[model samples]
Target chain A: MPMRTVRFLFFLLSIAAGIGLGLVYGWLIKTPDPGQLTPQVLRADFKADYVLMVAQVYQRDQNLAQAVQRLSRLDPASPARTVAQALLTARDLQYDPADLQVMSDLSRALQSLETPAATGEPAP
Target chain B: MNDNESRGNLYLFTGLILGLAVGLLISLVISPVEFVDIDPSAMGEAYRNEYRLLIAQAFQSDGNLQRARERLALLREADPARSLAMQAQQLVGEGASPADARALALLAAALTNPQGIAFTPQPSPTLPPGEEAQTTREVGQAIFTPTPPLPTRTPVPTFTPRPTATPMRALDAPFVLESRQDVCDGSLPAGRLVIEVFDRDGNPMAGVPVQVVWGQNQTSLFYTGLAPEISPGYADFQMEAGVVYTLRVGAVSDTLNDLSVPACGGGVRVVFREGR
Candidate 1:
């Protein structure tokens, strides 16, 4: 082959290799775990406003039972849980049949959550 | 390699490195990752202030003057808006009696928006002189003071006690007892019956059975209970002139058989009328 032609071929091959390497490096560096981007397991740190909006809608519709149920379904550890629980308590105060046992149960549930969890292994 | 080809290759390589460096520098400047530790104490203090304000508002709405005052006092101690706290304190100090103080405080608290507090309503402490004293005393004496009166015949014909008249009127029934005065966060006038039913936690109890009694006859009125379809909270009942009434509130349960009300526990008497 002519010397110029040979040099041209070599340059083309080098450019192709460089382009291929760049493509592979970009793919490897850019990939992210699918699980991390899922909607279900996303941390609910900033969901208070949405939760409160739903609760208020339930309340406005005078569906205290449904409001309470929806509120209870939320993760207890969520910051929104406090506001949800407060609204539920308010509903109970206004309308729930005054079952002392229910009140007692709620008190117990609040206390249990408020206390720190034990870390020691279970007894044999 | 020839000189011309070498120069072209060098330019391409230099351009690629310069472009890559520029891109990286732009990314670093525009969207740098940052780590910050939130000040929990400052956040907590802010939350506490908000909670205090909310409690004050609820109390004010319910005509609980004393409670409003107490909450505002706590808020003041916490160094929340100094001017607003001082204003609340001034209003509370003007209350004449303990009951007046409580009613005014609660009313003041209720006036604030619920969103402002972002907290649950705490149980209100029972106010002293809750309508009980007004019934037992002679019709005229009950209006003025707590003391029992000396039997004396005034020239003005003494108001005859009616044995058959219903003691309390229901909101939905024929005699719709509208709040004549803006009793919102204010004193409950003498001879007025304000019945508030509460559960064991002191939370307002809804839909309990309430009875108004006078002399020998008693009338039963179910508190328009709070259902999923209904508004939650107490069914407000007010008193009218010349008629004495007693309230009997039932327990918060389906079995209504467990009706336990303090006003009727020993039998309370309320005389309803406009002005003494």
Candidate 2:
């Protein structure tokens, strides 16, 4: 029994194996891509970006029902409020008011939306 | 256990610990999480442009340097002047159409030194060709003269009194904040803050008196809709951005200092499962 003695060597070899395993795991889990910004990473610009997305969606889709659904995810006070803020932000940013006419249309469309009370407010 | 068996167990434990430590070290160097170095020059390109434009517009409206500097600082630009110059050049280099020529010109105006003259974007097309050329010439003068020359004046001009202008007063604002969905001093304009009160049965309560107050005893009182639709347990009050208000409803009271962003997108919400 005194034989299997080199306990340190056994421990060292196992440690080495663990290190190799860790490297393998690291390679498998890819990191973020360069120049690639996800919605979560771009949290600071999300508010402004949200408005732009809404504008694009509103323009291409041109449907009030779907626009409201998409906008509701933004957690705005209301869809109309988001539109109003977008208009003001656009104005403040000096974007052409004419280009934001759709925002005004979206604003009107949101008025007919069944109020938050009907659907229940989204979770904070 | 035998000595050999006991020794093997110890070795295994040691190996596991060492392996984990080595692997962590290797991973740290060989495969770290990706992180791109962010700089103001590269990050939020659209947002930066828009913000710079806002600064220019605000400067136009107020002609206030201290305020302008404070706002531009938000862009994280150490040298806003340099940043503005590059943006102007970028705009012009983009081969902007004649319609966009003014915006390019505005960038130049923002970059101009000795900003004493007022700048109004979208120059009048009615300006005669020669006059417009002359105006451009003045801005061109600024592009080269990094260190602007001091204004030359023979003497203090005689003061001519101009008529004083009246200031626009904000309407008295009042709203209840005890319930959910109440906000104060929000940075954006939402519409009027509408709070709908409900009863124990989850039905909208009408004719509930709500009081809103701000600044030294000024108060406005209104009852939630007398009828379901009118008050429908719902009441709205006009609120100005950047002001704080206190609300009192049936002994439920709280403070709201959120700036309005548009109706209540998501500033305040008081949960009322057991609606009082």
Candidate 3:
């Protein structure tokens, strides 16, 4: 081919190669990596709040055993630990073996906590 | 170079430049971008308004005219917005003491502009009717000083029943048994028999299963299957005259350890002479 034609072809090929490199770079930058995102950690405050709420419900049901069990499961260093300890102390002061219903309800509640959450339900 | 070749080269270069420019413009236009929508001025005004409402509610709940007056005074200094200042001035005039009223007024005034407000003491305004007044006063006192003495009432004493102790006969074998009645009169008894088991160390073990067997002649009087109810740690068996009965308590723990007392095998061999 003549010199002018050869130079024109070289220039056209260079532009095409540049466009292809640009497209590849864009695709690589935009591609997402599933492993890069970490699963969300439960906030410490939320955990404490949940434990306190469950403890209050158990206390209302007069299930001291269950309340104590729930209290024991709470993070010992959490701010809610003081509340749990207070409740446990109060329960010890009033505990009576003759209160069979209270005892049974407490055992049942504590056992229920150990069971896995039902399908499509959030864990407490 | 030749005329045709030069023209072709010029055309190609122009096309590439135009394509590159267009692509760059399209990328810039389509790229995702985010912006904050809240107006800073409006946010500041909202904070001021919220603080005002909180202070007013607090004063109403506490019934502390003095604290209310002080808060209004502070509010007047901060905002001087004719409406807020006038409201604070009115609260102060309404029997609120100078010192407490002044403190509240100052807090409100300091919060008039967001810049001066350190932390909005978002007083909980939704307290129950019964607790509203007490809680408001508590909040006031908490801010001004330590909590004040709460009204005290003596608690009434409650009575609890004590468990009764009944003398039980010692079993020579592994167990001793007792029932509500040795013989039945066809009418069911009102109460149930409760059995308690204690380990050698005397601690109670829960969830022990017991098997009871009873019968008269060739037929069983009442099998464990037919009993109406049984207490925890105990088995109920219906009694019929002219029947021989036996009970067997079997536990896996007993079988695992040779010395572990079979939770079973407590015979209270009662040979009834007459129906009671």
Ranking by TM-score: 2, 1, 3
Error of 1 at B131 (Å): 35
Give the DockQ ranking, best first: 2, 3, 1
Give the DockQ (C-alpha) for candidate 3. Answer: 0.03
In the order shown, the candidates' DockQ scores are: 0.02, 0.14, 0.03
Tell me how far the alpha carbon of residue B186 in candidate 2 is from the true structure, in angstroms, after superposition: 57
Tens digit of lDDT per residue, candidate 1, span B54-119? 343333333233333343443234432333333333433453232222222223322332212212
- Report how far off residue A33 is in candidate 3 (Å): 52
Give the best candidate by lDDT: 2
| iRMSD for each candidate structure, in the order shown | 20.4, 13.5, 18.0
Q: State the TM-score of candidate 3 restricted to chain B.
A: 0.19
Q: Tell how far residue B115 is off in model 1, in angstroms.
A: 25
Write the residue-wise lDDT of candidate 3 on B49-72 in tens digits. 433443443332222233333333
Q: Write the per-residue lDDT of candidate 1 for residues A1-116, one digit (tens) a residue.
A: 99778666665655555554544443334333321221111112112222333332332234444434434434434423444454454343332222223333443444555567
lDDT of each: 0.34, 0.45, 0.33
Cα lDDT tens digits, model 2, A1-124, are 3444556566667887887777655544543443342222222222333454455445544656666655654443477776676566555544434335645666666766645445466777
lDDT of 2 by residue, B1-276 (tens): 699778768778777777867776666564454332122233346546744644443343333343344445545666675565455435434643321222222333333432311222232225344542111011011011112233331111111111121121111223233345545466323546566655555544433445668778877665443222232455566666556666665334444444343344434433221222
Q: Give the TM-score of each candidate.
A: 0.19, 0.29, 0.17
